[model samples]
Target chain A: MATMMNSTVFGTVVPHKNPTILRPLPCSLEELFCGKVKNYTHEKKIYDSSGKTFTVHKSTLQIYLKPGWKAGTKITFPKEGDVIPNIEPADLEIVIEEEPHPLFMRENNNLILRKNISLLQALVGFSFSVPYLDGSEFAVDVESLTFPLTPKVVQGKGYLSQRDGSAGNLVIFFNILWPKVLTEEQKSILKKGPLSECEYLGLL
Target chain B: MATMMNSTVFGTVVPHKNPTILRPLPCSLEELFCGKVKNYTHEKKIYDSSGKTFTVHKSTLQIYLKPGWKAGTKITFPKEGDVIPNIEPADLEIVIEEEPHPLFMRENNNLILRKNISLLQALVGFSFSVPYLDGSEFAVDVESLTFPLTPKVVQGKGYLSQRDGSAGNLVIFFNILWPKVLTEEQKSILKKGPLSECEYLGLL
Candidate 1:
């Protein structure tokens, strides 16, 4: 024998939630290289206590950005947008957008730097230094002859991954500056040298 | 005043049509450079005269591919797929896919060819020749010292536009081969000459 139980249930129908329009949050390379927390304050409509009336409410969304966050990174804040009569409140989406850097260009996780150097620097050794995105300077002593537009790779110097906490390589490209003309004496010296495949001097 | 008219209308309810799944058509660079016609034979179910029974029908789709057509190019055939009860047939979509070439690579409207040359050939003059995608050969009599990985652009030599009858450029890049060791005499000869910016000889 079982006893009879009565359960009364009442529920409100929920209309489809409104879609969120992407809002761009532009950040400089410096801010992307260093982690930061940003806060946004805006006004949105919310339901009053009577549930039929609407009132404006001020809300704030806090975003914690990690290092090396890239453009198109989306963060969704639930129920933070305006509320309509019978529909659920829309979500607020904040996407990260990068501004072009003065020194470095990012590809995936690698950082590329392009520079023009004199022919002397390409033949002999040269000291290379540049201020990094984090406002820190780095230097490399290049002992070998550099080729034009050839990348000199430095290990573990680029963007640090926010997910894996790992770093990528930094690539440096040098463009050679060729002299317009040579003197008579210079031409004679060049005409006298390296008869065979020895013209690529240093390696030979 | 216009004459009053009585028009009887007979209409049928239209159901939602089926969606199409894209079918990829692989093409060689040669075939893409030279226009070709491709035919595909397939079997599909269609309604019989009673409009209630299914019948298997064999059909063919002819594709006319033009020159310079790139990957992801789509061609749609209306109502060429299987038919179900009470709905229009799905459309057939054919997408172009590029096959890797043994000699040349395509970039937009341009063709790129990479080659490796000896150091002697780079210092002196060299003759360059390669078979193009259209089975035609091209030659260049390089009179200057060819720098490593420098590109020689030949205008109006690549893909011909099917729409406007225009053509693109052919870019040739050369990589230099360096000698592993040099004789003592060769090293001395290099050390004595070119103290100034005369090393980039022909230009300087």
Candidate 2:
């Protein structure tokens, strides 16, 4: 009987499985970067050993999301979807959805934070404290004048990929806040010529 | 002999043609809507009756651009590209490129002109003279409160489509000029309640 298991005529055949049903599991960028475990309770189907009788049952699914798990990543469960009496059960899949973070945006494994400063501060140098996921803050200084769209990037400070254990970059996007109106007194001070060429170009 | 022209052996075989070379012809949106004729003086390779030698010659290509021509629209000249010995000439194509206008942007057949107004003007409504390409002006009144990205569209004021002989539309994009700093006295005036609901939402 054990040797006959290798023969196709004696082997037991499995029925065709139904399609997959994907459910979105939304997570913030911080939660995905640090890793999290979430649970969902839903109605499931249970079948008898003979596959002739079925009943609805409540099931709790616990999902562990690793660090750097991007949106659209799927966690699948075999035959956990709708179960019919005659048809095969469908596969249940949970897809990761990245919700918009208040301060940070995730691109691949990298993180981007947009900061706006006055045009005067942009031409001159400015420094500000940047917050980390662990509630810690560090000063990121701009020694040189910064321009729009030319981000200041620090390597290996972004999310860590669990797939290959690779760390990504942290990007700081600076936006120049131009003055809506300038007084004649302020204009005279700028014309006295103490600022760099960047200031002149920005004002013009 | 006339019947033999249908046979495969008697049929004239055309040599393999080369790829197309596209040249950009940049034009202003106004020029495209009104129509213009422009000429280009370029060097052309002149091949004699035999497919053995070629000589360089100066040729002038005069192109008549039809009204309402959009960017990326192409005009083709068959076998007008490089002429090499024993090699078929490539097709020369002229692609239309829309230059940035001082006042307007084109989307489909519609023209969009962006205007900035004070926040108070946005809530209270305002009117201004909109300029036309022919140096004419008309008053456009905004009776209700306005928001960003919701433009005022006027039908049949846009670029004309030569393909279908249909007229386009004109769109006015309004941008709210929010005050950078509100005076204490001005804040009290608003708090006394005279502005519309749009102003409150904008401030918030």
Candidate 3:
């Protein structure tokens, strides 16, 4: 067994008794350089991930990266008007864990250090019945089905209706965490459950 | 005069330009009971305000509403379990105003609305930010800011933060949108012309 104690990605050890909300891991350490690493310095706001309980802001932080830059050691800042796509917020699961992820060696003679994780882990999605422009409400699912990149960012444009003549490529960040997996049959029950199965039903 | 448009609430004539991000008016009948609503009820999906995008899974939705309970109303529900107070994502903006809100309302049945509106109006506040033990995330925000109600909802126990040891009320819902009146010293710089003042450069 993996010894599923309350452990987090950042190597923080949370008490087994109390589970913590995990924060979405950023795309990469180099990516967190909100501005040019050269012009703008970096600062880390350390919190006692286990002891202190803080709420994460729901707003998406738009990162502006410099031009002509690729992911490598030579990190650069985003230039003005440069749009850094954010990870999906709905796909993110913020939590405080008991222990950080263990470090492992790669085939290349490099080491992978442990840190706080913020990104989509397995999957996340939601279902709701919202009113449409045609004057009737319908039940539909909004699944953060795929990612633009592995170790996904917290904000990214996900799937939308192609038939609707609205903005085709709408960008949004997922901030919700994934739910516990159920048997395939249980999931089917949820999908085909009675109209009154859900408790916190809200019309959008 | 501003372009004439079919107002959503109250069915009055109004100006058209940009959609308001927040408001106090209730969602219009056209928006509340659309064809999409039925599809989501039967299919268990969520339709965005644009009536275009939707998700498919229902497991995540079940976990998101774990602590909530259904009211006597068929579709309405409330939070019941852990007080995870945060803004709801579906209700991104709280209210939509078809007419501009005047600085002051006249007494009696006659109401004086604001004019020369640049966009539609709505008010919104962060509802809750809860983390599932399983790893999903959900946020709720309304379109309109209805005085103390929205703020109170934001400050409630189960909406945003899971819980902190500190007992005293925390300042989570600070008003960032209060129009900042120009200070005497700051106004003096603008009067001196944009590039004329050296101090303004540092401030920017």
Candidate 4:
């Protein structure tokens, strides 16, 4: 069978150098899902050996974002290139830049978020809610005796994969926060309690 | 001082899959040098699991080409891309595909052409004209005892480099073509002659 010709090019949407959040600034999740259009301007200057400058090309451009687009997702445009004389104008490829998200790290299609919890919660059990990429909140339940630095996974809650268009899991890593100082009474209580193993090692 | 934003997005003007010539078909060197605008159309389709296909997007676009544009040259279009929400639209980048030319080959900014010459021309001297990229013709002189498969260079007759904008040289390779058969009279006339070292080898 004859193959179809590719009429569009791919490009990356890069994130800012210092991104403060996982999502784009001033944009809501709903806006990203529904797609958005923006106006942009670009300029260049050519300098000679004598430092004489020439304004080469400058103009404003329109950037389009489709619904469900994310970092590393290629945005394509049709017939947005040079004229091929008699044939057709080539397509433009926009490779979405794989910029690091400030609050969330990406692995394949999965999203990773790290959170700190109290020592008590790590020993017993805890329940909490985290913000999903879609702006909705999802609850995370850590079972009793859940170890600090361990990861708990919430399946099917991650960024959409551009390769297969499937969603991935959201992994949460727990960091235990220990009290910096203990009162005399608290230290005495711990010493007489069931922490004898630690007391023998002078950790009490 | 604040830095200036890039307003122009660079894209490649890809060569044809089977490029017969350097310039695109139906395009003259004059037209390429003067710049031209041509109409183009693009289409795409979406298919379901049941093989139900639907046309997604179709549009006619205007493709612009500037003068002195060649294969591997980047063309820029200002403000031609998707619009970002509240922010400016992103610029589109076109990457020209490096395709093989049937008659001429490219290396960096230089051009290469190979031609075949008669055995007599390789032993004696010969001269000929070769076509330049800019539609001009230049003469090439081969000195006596020119070796086969050796290249003769013509300076300042190559593509303009996008980096430095300086021109390069054109290199020509010679291929010697031997006569298929010799008649008896021709063979006898050469047998009784005063033979040089090479002539003795030929006779043997």
Rank candidates, DockQ, best first: 1, 2, 3, 4
* Runs with alpha carbons beyond 4 Å of true place in candidate 3: A1-34, A39-68, A73-204, B1-204
DockQ of 1: 0.12
Candidates 2 and 4: which is better by TM-score? 2
lDDT of 2 by residue, B54-170 (tens): 688788888898888899999888888767644577788989999998898999898989887754455446799987864678888986656545789888889898778889998
Model 2: runs farther than 4 Å from truth? A1-13, A47-54, A86-88, A196-204, B1-204
Q: Is the docking of candidate 2 incorrect, acceptable, medium or high quality?
A: incorrect
lDDT of 1 by residue, A15-126 (tens): 6566685788888777887878887676787765445667889977788888889988999888777766555677888999888988788887788888776554555557
Clashing pairs in 1: none
Q: TM-score ranking from best to worst?
A: 1, 2, 4, 3
* Candidate 3 lDDT over residue span A1-204, tens digit each: 112245455786543332222242223222221223222222222223242433332333333443212232222222211111221111222221112213221111111222221112112223444332223554545443323122322121211222442221212232322222233343333333221122221222
Question: Per-model TM-score of chain A alone?
Answer: 0.79, 0.81, 0.16, 0.57
Please tell me which model should have the higher TM-score, number 1 or number 3.
1
**Model 3 chain B worst lDDT run, 10 consecutive residues:** B115-124
- For model 4, the superposed segments whose C-alpha errors exceed 4 Å read A1-70, A78-91, A98-102, A194-204, B1-204
Identify the candidate with maximal TM-score. Answer: 1
Candidate 4 docking DockQ: 0.00
Question: Lowest-scoring 10 consecutive residues by lDDT in candidate 1 chain A?
Answer: A1-10
DockQ of candidate 2 compared with the true complex: 0.05
Compute DockQ for each candidate against the true complex. 0.12, 0.05, 0.01, 0.00
